[model samples]
Target: MWQPLKEKIKIHWPLLALAGVSALSVGMVVALLETVGVLNLAPADSAIVESELAPEAPSAVLGLADRPPAQRTEALSLIAQQQDNQEGHRARYLLATDLLSQGRGGSALTVLDGLEQDYEALAPYVLLKRAQAQTAAGQPEAAQQTWQTLAEQYAQHPAAAEALYTLGQSDESTWEQLIANFPAHPRSVEVAAKQLPVATGAKQMALLRLLVNYGLHQSEYGTWLDQFVSEYGSLLTPEDWQAAGFGYWETQRYGKAGSAYAKAPASPLSRYRAGRGAQLDGQRKAAIAAYRQLAQAFPDAPETATGLLKLADLLPQPEAIKVLDQVMARFPNQAATALGKRADRLDALQSPTSAQQARDAVLSQYSQSEAAAELRFRQAQQQAKAGHYESALSWAQQLLKDNSTHQLAPEVGFLAGKWALQLEQPEVAQRAFERVIGQHPESYFAWRSAVYLGWDVGDFDGVRSLDPQIVLPDQRTPPPAGSDTLKELYLLGQDQDAWTQWQNEFRDRESPSVAEQFTDGLMRIGVGDTLDGIFMVSNLAWREQPQARQEYLALQADPAYWQAMYPFPYEQLIETWSRQRQLNPLLVTALIRQESRFVADIESVAGALGLMQVMPGTADWIEAQIGQTGYDLTQPADNVELGTWYLDYTHREYDNNALFAVASYNAGPGNVADWIQRGGFTDADDFVRQIPFAETQGYVEAVFGGYWNYLRLYNPAIAAKVERLAATQPNS
Candidate 1:
């Protein structure tokens, strides 16, 4: 959703309030002026200015957490004084929370009073807190009444679930009601954990459903699922069997899922999952039979096409090719991928001629298909990799000519432009780049094309001076699919409400449409589950579903699509660190986005911590060099400060080239130095291409791609300039 320009416009107040200035002593006024960057007499003053200003603009919600207790108290006091807006309510809430933590329950209750109507999204939470404060203040009867009111009014909210659990602590009747009314709530898991011991039949099944659907990934749920299957397998109904199968699937118990799904084979999805689960569980014969049955029974179903493709992969050579041919004939739009796989096998079998023949068939038969475009682009890549620039250029040109509207067309044009440069065809390269700019102005590669055309969009040294403007429309159009109410809730920033509504509405977990999955991802992100949301949305790029692909294509043109994909979670930390290090903030943001996906507390398996994924040893070295101490690497500000220092060090080591610095950041300075020596590559693009480590190569592309996306989506000036470039480019 597009925020109003008023919201986007930030007004930075001086650190010292004007009202207090007159009362302050002369020394205090000078100190305050120095703190706010008003004193510009010396280099030391600049350093002091940065240190004082950096922490002042932390993330709106998370900044309070980063502040010291004293600062937090002062901040909240200021906000509470202006109690007339959202910030005021937020401040009161935080102040109450802090007071409660300090055992000032009466004070907390005073702060929370009358905030119910003003904070509808957090009303249930306010009530829950009020109840807790009541209990702490020795008003147990009042607390109980508040809890009852909460449960009755906000039954679907997680706060209500917590309230019910609290009420259930002394009342078994409340516990039973909790289980009956909120079977899918997280608190119901606690109820089931207690009741499952003596439960039987329908009660047992219901408990299992609650555990499977809402419970955390724990061994106890696995144990309960196993027990339920063993005790009631023979007597369960079809729906129960299906539910059990879904439960098993959720837990990754593939073999058990297959068995449960086998009992409910009437559903096409169940049949497909039965096959997939059996295959994953190493029951090859059962998997084969299940897939065959699904394809035979549901010949016209979409799952049938997928079933045949899976069946092809499991079968022998000629038989595999025969099955692929059937898919190609029946599902032509899907055939290019099928044909490409078949071609790979042919090449692996020492039949290059047959491989070429298969690829040729796809191009000749389905030249306008997305598969054809993909196959041609891949062929261009293969030719380029083999040093046959002319042949690669030919394939790329033909791909654009034949599949102009295909998703990969811009990619082909970009590659063609790169190949033209390699082949010393500047005119051809310019035309190709122009075509990419004109035809796919929204793509990252279009930005690349713009840069190559000598637009001052920004580079490593010059980005600091570039004032990229981001233009957002007054309103954002909702996604083409999903419940209107859920969309509205999301737009209003009521993520919990949207998530709860989505959980109730989202059925057919076995086979969701692309739009459903994308919406699910959005809801997941809204609820602070960034990694799962990223996986759900990013995985759609490779989806074979025609409708899903179309939906994805449609979304690509929207700025919100990119923003959702590449969110700037820790803006203050990244900006502070980047500015301190004299680096491009967008570039730092790109690296952090790649490293941690904005998960502040995430640690890689290699022990890298926080937003920048700084390793402990590296942090120690950086600390020693900078004379900084007592820094927690798991903290966002500290991690980014150290990471940017390391990044700046790398850039200086490489004479300020971002390509080498980014590569070094991933593979380490030693490996990157060795690669530079061996490859003797001077051009940044050439250096990137010749990097031996595939992971490092991909990382560079992803980081830079993130940078381009940030510029296009967030910076209005750069976005407008690029749009103008696209408009001026010759259409042909």
Candidate 2:
């Protein structure tokens, strides 16, 4: 529904990131910052899952496992002693792991003794930990024997891969077994790395292929794949090329991907990718030829349409018109855009008559299309820029007559209303504002309309203090894909193990099923990988294939997608600090998600650090004012406390106006002060459009849009209001 708007405007919400940070000191700090949350062993809502075991199981996950391991070991031990039932398994395992990690392995061994027999479902993990405990306890022989037993007995288990990896540290042949049996195991990456320098022939190719296929999309894998192509290009099969091409493509080595895709299996997609990659790689002639070949070979395929458009971009005005003419004739769905592009080409060719005819054809025949809407929108903007309010209103109304439900309609309606106010037409402005709030309650424009139309949603200045009720889900959405055991592991808060198991199962990295990708995203978030997690989940929107897009739509029909996209990370810190600063918690959370995506120690290009992206200079100023010292910006608590205090300061600077404060946060005070002083805006929304900086303009919308999503997704009352408003509108 919002697809057209996506091309015309930045939606700003559901911006999922594919998150992974390398093991820098900062990475360790992020882990430490998020580990307590990652523990998932803390007190949780009773409704964490729904099952026969939901009562005991969720508590089982929480009863003894909810606290940080180091802080709550003895408490877990006491709980384990109290309950030797099924729940004791979790308690004991937690106790044992704590003991092992803290180097009291003998104590861990006593706790873990015979746990394999009792906890049959987690027997492999038990055995693996037992071996680790043995090694840590200086029982080298016992550890060796235990590793051998695990490798020999549970060789098929994912945990057994770890055992084999450990044993292979001393024996090369054991790694060979690991490579042969568990190619997808993460340990295989290690095995490949360990043996890569010494390997040759099929053995060497096999290691490279393993890394290429399941190297976790690391940067080095791109270099390795390049070498593999260099040495064994002739020996590689089409399937190998497909994998290699995907690796190169993911790494943005478009030239390599173009080369690899040329050798991959002949298909519309491969051909399109080959051309597209070539285009991006700046091999213009190759790209043009590939695109032309694709259009000829797969005339009816969707890729041909995309390829043709790209092909036209490489051609001159005259030649581009011909390609666009072909698109107009062949693909009715794309004909509007084709006509619009052709009009520009015709104008560039100085054939004004032909250009007007082309544009008129679009407005008359494809009036409802995104192209027509955008064309009309441009006209409106041109008139508005020229101070022709009446003409601008006419064009915006014409745009809405065709596309009232489009993503841009809300913005247009709001603009029309604002323009009406400029023209002193109060009734027309009120009706236009009503249309925006009625049709697109989720949009930022609706929030503006609500404030102008006198709804109680709060305004730019008042929104910061309005503490809307927040609601957490009764239970997390069940996994859309993966094994029951995978679900079990996830539900139990066994984050590391679950992620490892998921990695072993999720082999179709290049072309994942929607459910698989969504599951992948959820697991990533489970392990404090919010950037990647949100990315994997939210990127489902880009699926182009019919089945994939259908699956994506089905997944999105549920509330799960939105919830996961706007997850409540670092809530404890956000709420505590927000209360401390007398700011809205949701607003703080929105800013944090926008700033660092809940990555505790993330540093931006501008040297802003931590969850709120506070600059060192600002932090120093804040410290001097508050008389606090020695606060690390990388720490979540420290960052939030400082950031919220600054947020408060910014609010005070603008007389408690959130709009000005959020703008100040991104563009800094000097720019904001300048914008405010030079403002000719009618209201806050108009003020946004007048902001000279595109990034700051978008930042204001993004931050507020993020805030609205949090409120809509987490606040039941506001959600019901949005739904009620949407229900009254025909195509909202």
Candidate 3:
């Protein structure tokens, strides 16, 4: 039987202090190891792999992208076994690709013979491949004919652009035709780069913008921007300056970004970014002037609060304290953080009495403020850490009552529930968990609440038995902005058309609306650039723009909004692997979302690869254990197959304890075992709260949070339950 913590226990602050010191030491060690390249933490793997593998050969065969080049032989062999169905058709196309890669152009053409009708989506690619093969086999006339056929038949396709570029090797007119007809295709970048020196005025500006929007190489773009600015700085419009600022900012040229933004727009956000850029560039006086100007010009803007905060950081203590006080008085919700800083400064100045007074003032004057709630929440954490569960519960409850609408409300409510469980107050804990679901269903903590309530979604044991039904929304509203044609393209799954259209029309990149950002992310995802797409969508949660935040908050009220946000791409692959491993498909999907954001070829700094981020060493070990070989971690199917097997293995190690399994997956069984031994944590919440590694702790929350989001967004029963709880809330 599971035992809750006893209601009464001796409490001491010194014990909590000791725990904090120990956790900090552990964190430092982990950080040091990571800094020196010893710790192979999972989340950092993607960035590492991307930088290391970027210059390698492209990892796709007939659009089966991200597979390792070393696996071409294995892939070809696998495709040979299935030559009768749709898989067989795909296999043949890939087989041709493999042959072409190996300079066996005649063999590749032989394999591609008469398959044009069968591979409709890949027809242009097949022809292009065949043409290259012909050229490789020294049949120049045959290659020319094949390229001409592709150019004539697939003029609108990207393959046509490639074909034109190839034909342009001997004829400049063909390149000019490519530039005229397919200006949005990537090959146009190459054409424009070659022609940019002779281009003038409007044409030059247009080409520059295209280069920036398409994310050209940094060295090349920087040279282009510098040359363009030097020649045309005085002739450019505010919009041109804005575009230049965005391009510079994206490339981390903060000094240039600031200079450009200073001349671009007078919007609060623009001014803030200008100041931020200047600050980062070490232009202290200019940054201060920009901040002051923004504060005076747009006092009511959300940027003004941030400006004031930054200004305080640069000012003398007395001036800083005054600015901090102003921030707390004007932006109470945002003020708690500023006030906390003020309290810390007072203490640091050896004014303990003053610090106490300042803290008391926040509690009394801003009792209903977020700062007060934060103070109370901190106190609760301290009490809990000190083993004073009853006191912690009281403070947490007070925070809930006073600051229910504050951003920290969900976290406080969840913590209160955890403390209640520690105090053996099951009923109180249940209500607290219910309140979290009712009031803040979109939060990661809401998922934690669901786990405690024994929902089958990512539950320790229930996941093994419960079969969840996935219910997708029947109708999705098109994004509010964008042309009707572009919207239609997106709705119709004409991803390339929609992407090109979006790039051409998406003008305010610096200050896009929440909807526009979301749409932009969707467009990027649609075009198979998962990294940037996921970055854009996931970044919305941190936006400080008042209007954008309000729009996001309003959108969160709708279930469809979340469904779009946490989309389930690669459903067939996820389902096949989940079923094979006897796991919930949604759980597998959630894990993939966290691991790689569904980016098939993303590698982490720790060298974890593909959708589930399995490390190379782990893959080798799993292969040995499962008696499987020739699996490519970069390929989606292979990665998921091996990843899910590892997931299942972890579950079995802990007797289906999802919490332990997830932690073990991230930090490894060795580290998890050490933490378990050190903390002697039996309860899930207790173990999570006391987990020494902040990285592992966050990973657990994120994985389970993603699991709950999938459930409420996709499972009808869970969605209805969430809706019902939300409807019963006082705010609702």
Q: lDDT (CA) for every model shown?
A: 0.72, 0.79, 0.74
- Candidate 1, residues 1-732, lDDT tens digits: the string is 111122221222222321221244434434433332222222222343224221123223223432334445554544344224444465566666666666767777887888778766567778987998888878899999999999999986556777888998988778877777766655677789888889887887777767756653344877877777788777777877787788788778898898899887487888888999999999888988999998888877777778888888788888888888888878755777788778977987789999999888878977877678888888899998889999999999998888877777876888889899999999999989888877776555776777777876665445544444433332233444566555545543456656765665666555677777778778777776777777777877776566767778777666667667876667767777777888888888889889988878888998889888999999989989989799998788888889999999998998887778888999999998999888766566667768889999889878877887788667776677667766886543
TM-score ranking from best candidate downward = 2, 1, 3
Candidate 3 at residue 135, lDDT?
93
Query: Model 2 over residues 1-732: C-alpha lDDT tens digits?
Result: 001111222111111110111223423433332332222221212232111243223343343343456545544443354444445566677777777767877777888878888666678888888999999989999999999999889878788888888888898788888888888877888779778899899889988888888885454776788778888889999999998888888778898888889889999978999999999989999999999989988999988998998899899998998899899899988899899999888888899998999899999999999889988988999998889999999999998789885668989998899889879999999888878877766577887777788866678888888888886753455677887657656655577888887888887787788999999998888888887788788788788777887888778767878888888888878998898899988888988888888888788888999989999999999999999799999998899999999999999999999999999999998999998788787677778988999999999988888887788878887788767766676653
TM-score of 1: 0.74
lDDT of 3 at 145: 95
Please tell me which predicted candidate would have the highest lDDT against the true structure. 2
Q: Lowest-lDDT window of 10 residues in candidate 3?
A: 12-21
Choose 1 or 2, whichever is better by TM-score. 2
For candidate 3, write residues 606-697 as lDDT tens digits: 89999999999999999999897999999999999999999999888888777888899899998887887787665777788788899998
Q: Candidate 3's error at 199, in angstroms?
A: 7.9
What is the Cα-based lDDT of residue 398 in candidate 2? 91
How close is every model to the real structure, measured as TM-score? 0.74, 0.80, 0.70
Considering only N, C-alpha and C atoms within 3 Å, which residue pairs clash in candidate 1? 469-715, 469-716, 469-717, 470-715, 470-716
Q: How many residue pairs clash in each candidate?
A: 5, 8, 8
What does candidate 3 score in Cα RMSD to the true structure? 18.2
